[model samples]
Target: MHNPPRILAVDDVAENLEIVFVRLQAHGYEIITAADGEEGLARAREQKPDLILLDIMMPKLDGISVLRELKHDESLGFIPVILLTAKADRADVVAGLDAGADDYLTKPFDQSALVARVRSMLRIKALHDLVQDQAEKLAEQTKELAAFNATLEARVSEQVGEIQRMSRLKRFLSPQIADVVAASGDAQSLLESHRREVTVLFCDLRGFTAFTETAEPEEVMRVLNDYHEALGELIDRYEATLERFAGDGMLILFNDPLPCDKHTERAVRMALDMQATIKAHASVWRKRGHELGFGIGIALGFATLGRIGFSRRFDYSAVGSVTNLASRLCDEAKSGQIIIQTRAFHAVEGLFEARELEPMTLKGFRRPVEAFEILGAMKQEEKSAEA
Candidate 1:
């Protein structure tokens, strides 16, 4: 009962285009025609039809070239492309495959065969689109939770410290980073063991002065909600431990209380991801109209682990200079920048493209410390043109 999938048929010859369009339209599908590869590419970007039936030879551009372009662009790479060409030779088939065509049909093909292939490709496209949409929705939901948790942090800092560290072992193990600590026992038992290598990350929204002076309390709460909620999801994805939130900021420990071989890099990754998330959500806010910014800091080191607080008013959290320095670094970071200490940088340098920021001074620190900015994840993808 639903409308048929839209198909884009690309060919230079008006006759060939007519035959393919007529066959597909007879099956009750909406068809868009493109007489050349260039036009096909343009239509692909604009309409993003479910399936593209492209002829091998065309003016201005060719099918193979169009396929290459489509696969290269991140946005269009997933759309299915089926080559409808006259060339049936092995060499032609190999060339089409090399160019990234999803499937191919020789010219003078059967109407039934054409319909079958189009249907099959459209089915796959529908599934792919559905999965992508679900993933984006999930990410958005996680972002929402992190944002809500962020607001709650400022109000229930006391209750959270209590609820989070239900068991004594959780207290010393750094509950923020302890995903499996429950498998172990109380916080007191954790301190009995030797310390482990771990990275600690601290992040905060910079420009509190400007935000408070310029924005409403409700607006400020909304921004915090978006940032924290999104960061929580990303932290879960990387399997990093969230220690606790400090005011409008958060403290996360990596390879902590436990050993995560990738803790250092994961810390860097979380920082970069949080930055990316804020930018992605900024537009959502902008649509509703709001301005926002965030800052991140990371440090790595071994620290003595233990629980400290009255048995009645107890909590689980990290201590030592590593934690302090990370917090200090975050406080000192500029908006939208991820600042990392030298030790932290070397740990993830091999995996990330990190650039050095100027040495920064901390309130309680004796000297200006070395810091670096994470540019992005390693480049593994190439740009491609797509129709």
Candidate 2:
């Protein structure tokens, strides 16, 4: 709405139009005059005036017809219209009001009343414009809010899915190592191919193949469950990364994915705990008439470790001579024996009592691999000092 409201005055008589134009224009109003109803509609459409004064009797179209046309048009419907009728009859006045005229005036207009009515209509139009503008802004803000909520929902869903996947991975990872993997900014970076000196321990039951051949499927599962439950606790206790467990054999790593202090000593301790645990389980198996023995081989050296296989099927694994040597040594070990190559035995020497074995050529190695059988660990006080 402008400071000086624009008004349209339509009359077939030239004298009436001149009077309205002169009077309103003198009172700080912009007046647009039209000679007939059709001409008034054209001027109203062009100017979009704040108020329209339409004459009842005009050529081409009457005031009631013009008012009806304006009321039906969405864009022009809300503009206030005042009807000018000379009849002074109640019927014509009612007809004008019924046709959506805001107010009406008789011929020989009163100048004071005309100004007051124009001021009132202008005030209404200004308030309506303000309300419409605010409504449009509110609608736009609501749209923006909906978009933001949709994006937030998607982000939350993605995060929840990631947590679910991490929970599934926890099935195979030690709790201590699982915490590290979860805290890392990029879990993939931890699995990317890299070479590092890691302590690899390979272990399996001594008579597992024979026992499985003779034992029922349920019995095999029962033994394996008991075996894993016992060893699984110790594995987590030592914070060693359990790479993979296949039926009985488990390959573990230390000083990898995240660094561990005195990794060699830790591996040896875990191996000793495992041997002791298996010894207790052996008596149970013996009672059931199903004999099983646990053996472990530990080796320390540089190895390549990373995620292996395609997108869906994969694992974080270690591959190199170190892993091979540990597996081969485990193959050569007797029931209840924990064997170690010279490289690893030397690393954690004096921490445990081990007997040197006669040099024997192991599979896949050109020279005889120097090895030792761990007999026992040092006293608790001395081991604590080593820690």
TM-scores for every predicted model: 0.49, 0.69
Could you give candidate 2's per-residue lDDT for residues 1-387 as a string of tens digits?
A: 656888999999999889888888999999989999899989988888889999998989999999999998887747988888888999999999999999988988798888788888888888888888798899999999899999999999988977875774465567877777877757778878999999999999988999999999999999999999999999889988888899999999999878789999999999999999999999999999987888899999999988788866777788899999999999989998989999999998878988999997988999999999998897888778877
C-alpha root-mean-square deviation, candidate 1: 30.4
Which stretches of model 2 miss by more than 4 angstroms? 1-145, 164-172, 380-387
- How good is model 2 by TM-score? 0.69
Stretches off by above 4 angstroms in model 1 are 1-179, 185-188, 191-194, 287-289, 381-387
Per-model root-mean-square deviation over C-alphas: 30.4, 6.2
Q: Give the per-residue lDDT of model 1 (tens digit) for 1-387.
A: 125788999998898888888888988899999999999999998887888898888889988898888889888747788898887788877888898888989987888999999889888988888898899899999999899899888669866754665554433333344536654555347544456667888887655557667778888787778776788788777777666775477888777556777788778877888888877886686676455567888898877654456757654466678988888888877777788899888876656666888788887789988888777776644212211
Q: Which model scores highest in lDDT?
A: 2
Candidate 2 — which pairs collide? none
